[model samples]
Target: MPIPGNLLTTAMAVMPHTDPERAIQTALSLDIPFWPQLPKFDYTEDMYVQASEHFPGIVLDMTAKTLRFSMDKFLAEFEETMAHFDDPAYFDISPAYSAVYHRFLAMDHSKRKAIRGQLEGPVSFGFNIQDQDGRPILFDDTVRPFMFEFMAKRVNVQLERLKALNPNAFMFIDEPGLQFLFSAMSGYSDRAAKDDVGAFLDRIERPRGIHLCGNPDWDFLLQLDMDILSLDVYTNGEVFGSYSGSIRKFLDRGGVLVWGIVPTNMEPFSKESMDTLEARLIAIWDMLAKKGIDREWLLSRSLLSPATCCLVNPDGERTVEEAFAMIRTLSARLREHYALDGD
Candidate 1:
């Protein structure tokens, strides 16, 4: 499992179909093009939309940016929706996803190494959605399983679509909320957390990965069945480096590691030179190597990224494209520097 000399970015970063032709043009420009989450086009593109849509007693005021679920209402719809999980329409993805995907299909992908599709993991989605009383859905016994089914179906659909285009296409479960699982209020035990993630990953096959934008219980993830572990290396590289034993074990078992070594913020992106960023990545490897992982093993298993999604500037959408261009240049320099394998 040699690392693909390609970059990865979430859908939150790219805008599609705002100008149909231009959107596709921008998508093709990336080294590793992925399905974009055009939230600006429609709020439904937010990670939780697929699961929230079939909530039993859901209340949404998109204009006001509010959502409150009704347990009673949810319970009623829960049976039907859960029973119809196999039906394609039951887990229909947003048009924003389809728009980018269709455009991706129409374009030439011969030069692309691997493309990616991402979804909000069940843990994060459950922790974020709340009942009318403001209680988190993760604490609700009835609603929890329903949410898992909802997201599982959604991920299955997305994976099927991406695999149809290319088997090398990667699917990732974004779990930013895992960082708070140990807090008193989250009510998740280590075993329960593993169970939740396992449920979400049950249908996912190889070439799948998990992206945690925040520092999390890395040990738990290391024990999971994912082929890749994507981290917020720009911020948590040291924390991750401390787990050198786990890193060695994971890589030894053929897992890929994506170092989110690039900074996503405009200030850092503008300030850090390519040499500085490359040195930063090398430093991380040096730390891991000291802990007994071979440097070449570390490099062979590594991928590069700009943490997660970078937000668009208040005044200009072009800033995002500029940032991505910087990322493309950085990716090229790193690959050439390491003589990494190409797609």
Candidate 2:
């Protein structure tokens, strides 16, 4: 919760790929902190979820296989709850959630301060769990409320797990599926996206953030009590061009804007360079300044990434190499240009 005293233009990287020791070193060298992501290591992984994927749990009463949670046998426990939903204390994400928390604690020393953890947002996750007819669970009113409550609980659980390691750390609500949730899904009633569901989320532990790789309903998303607004730096700038006024209000209020400048794909990743990156960043800062938003004020809340996800382009060699290199150079530039370390 160190309100980023200065501008923090840094990289958000995939932990498995980044050498643990090197990542810490790179972070300090880059003059920014690291956001560790472990998606590949676990798919139905507690933190991340493919919200649109029709997970089997919604149908057939939460079968054991459907839960498929084994990190700490969460699936087995989930099966017990499903078999006995009437039990007074049938909670979801139970012991596996507990085990994941302890596991993360052991990782504290490896990855330092402000360690980040993520979870799928309610609208997206709720809809992902499906009914037997292959319809979204969100379509079922009886199930929808439960889904939201669970999503909120799950997010809080994930935050607690991580915060038990460092209370001030951040917890990102990985709501990539929100684009569709608010745009096309049935779950999106006027109140579903904000008021009703947000009522539960308002109590979540740690600072909450949402990442949108595609365009989002900004007017609605800006409603959440979120601390950071992460956008696909490459595409969002073009996608949300007209919302400059609202964005300015958000920025002015000390809310961090994660400008995902790095291309999540190849050509753009390869196409960008230090001078190009700096120009783009300064240009962006200048753009907001035009709206009467102070450059330095905006600077304090800006977070950077090479791409939303690790430069995932089939042109892997060129794209990944350039993307990683850009991280180092970008970090150095932001540090030196701003004197982040203090001479």
Candidate 3:
């Protein structure tokens, strides 16, 4: 499936509020509703927290929302866990998972193209999670491969649940931490990175997308066998533009470009109206179109989203709501101009 005309702000400001009702409320309000990831709604729903389900010998500090592992014990149990990776006990679909998903199950689907679900990408998961020695698992020879395998299988679990609702279930493997891939670790080669990421991408039978907010290896990501390459175009649009050849090939091969054009920061959010943001996106698109890319092809293969998740102020739920409104407004403006599908 191509990326939908529906807004990809599906994972927007779901933190800082613990009420399941708020997640449902937010999803209900979207032009193209999506399941929410409300870690604040349930600490257990935090990206790493939820990933802890398959890792044995990992200590969960609910108070701090961190996972600690005894390296020896984790490896000792590795074989046993691998044998039962498909067990229902390995994936915890609870609290916010049910809250957001149940609402999606009940949604009026006649007009919907697909459902969007999110998971922590293997790179980001290993980067964020630590061992008892406070070491990031990404750099660990013993644990990193295991983490990658664990996350790869975790996707299978998520897909099974999502496919039950919508066959065209789209999973956006959020990998914001990939920007640190080179700087934060040594001995991690592009080939190694490809293998690590490919482990998951190769297994996704349904359409899959990758979302990265920071400047990453565009050349590497665009060539992946994935459906969508979502980026923070509002901030890094020029960076991506520098790789015209690769971008052209990606589009030529039927990959979708999810233009993350809406600003997630407050300063830009305050200054830009829907018209201005739409213009920004058009300018970028026009540049690409001029480079021998077809305008209609680009429009048909693109999606609009905020550059990043909206940052929520401690007392500013309304501000978050406004951010979502801005995304929908921009999406509406794009649809008006492109005649994109939205019902």
Candidate 4:
């Protein structure tokens, strides 16, 4: 597919609090279908926490209101099972996998052109699962490979058809945990190493990109094959420059860059304005241009918005409305700069 080479926001999946109509409307109004977040109801409803039937013997759910995993059933089921995390025969998705997919389908098919899906990156997934003692599974050699392969296959089965329907759809694996991954010590397993991380990435396919957000594990991720490199350029904008060589290589490989240009959690609505932010973006664009990375549609590729990053507590409904306002100005500037039309 000839992916549109313009700007886009992180597909902020409809959380528990967001009005479904509003979430779908937000994607439609902004012209982006890939909203990878679904923590709209409670923080614990996260994809990892909402374990599917595919991965049996692992109990990741709790009626708890926060983001902690429930260990009662898990510990009971896997008394010596932390070692089982690496055992391939033990890592089967429950018979209920279809039910989970069915639930996702209900929401994704809610409207036409609903570009709905998720992300699953090697570095992050390698870091999410834990051992029998409830530690980073990546550090446990007996299990890292099993966990990695399971996640890769699981991610594809969950998202493949979603992409088929929307074609322009996207999926993201929330791997914000990669930044903390370091080389293994004598007792720790080295799952985050470039080669180890790349192995899992090799398991997945790409066209609509995966997101690389929060903290920089750039030595590996930015260099991988992908459709976009999502960054919070507005606040953490300085991080991307840390890997100048890798980033340039990523762009040269036809990777689109999605700048998290809007403020979320940090800067509030009172301090935001399109005119002010545009000047900041112009400076960033100029910096990229100096590297011979500038393209006319670069601004479009540079998404200018934020999403309800935290859904459990809920921001204002107008939070999305505020983001749309800035994006509107951005769209106008882009249309004029590129002389684009209703093609």
lDDT value, residue 333 of candidate 1: 79
Q: Is 1 or 4 the stronger prediction by lDDT?
A: 1
User: In candidate 3, what residue range of length 10 has the lowest lDDT sum?
Assistant: 5-14
Once fitted onto the true fold, the runs of candidate 4 whose alpha carbons sit more than 4 angstroms away are: 8-10, 14-18, 40-44, 51-53, 65-116, 120-122, 125-132, 183-192, 297-304, 312-315, 338-343
lDDT of 3 by residue, 1-343 (tens): 5356333344432344567677667665664456666676666657666666657667777788667777877868878887887675465355433455555556654455665667788788788777778877788877787777777667667766766766666777888887877663577776777777877688765578788889988887888888877788888987788788889899888887877776656677778887788788778778888888888777777776666765365444555667667877777777776776666
User: Best by TM-score, which number?
Assistant: 3
- Residues 272-313, candidate 1: write the lDDT tens digits: 777887788789888887788987767766666666566455
Q: Please, what is the TM-score per model?
A: 0.88, 0.74, 0.89, 0.76
Which whole-number lDDT from 0 to 100 does residue 239 have in model 4?
61
> Could you give me the TM-score of model 2 versus the true structure?
0.74
- CA-lDDT, candidates in order: 0.68, 0.56, 0.70, 0.54
- Sort all candidates by TM-score, best to worst: 3, 1, 4, 2
Task: List the candidates ranked by lDDT, beginning with the highest.
Answer: 3, 1, 2, 4
Among all windows of 10 consecutive residues in model 2, the one with the lowest summed lDDT is 67-76
lDDT string, candidate 4, 197-287, tens digits: 6776677656545554467567577776666656566766666655667766776677766666655443464587777666777676777
RMSD of each: 2.8, 5.9, 2.6, 5.1
Quick one: best lDDT, which candidate?
Answer: 3
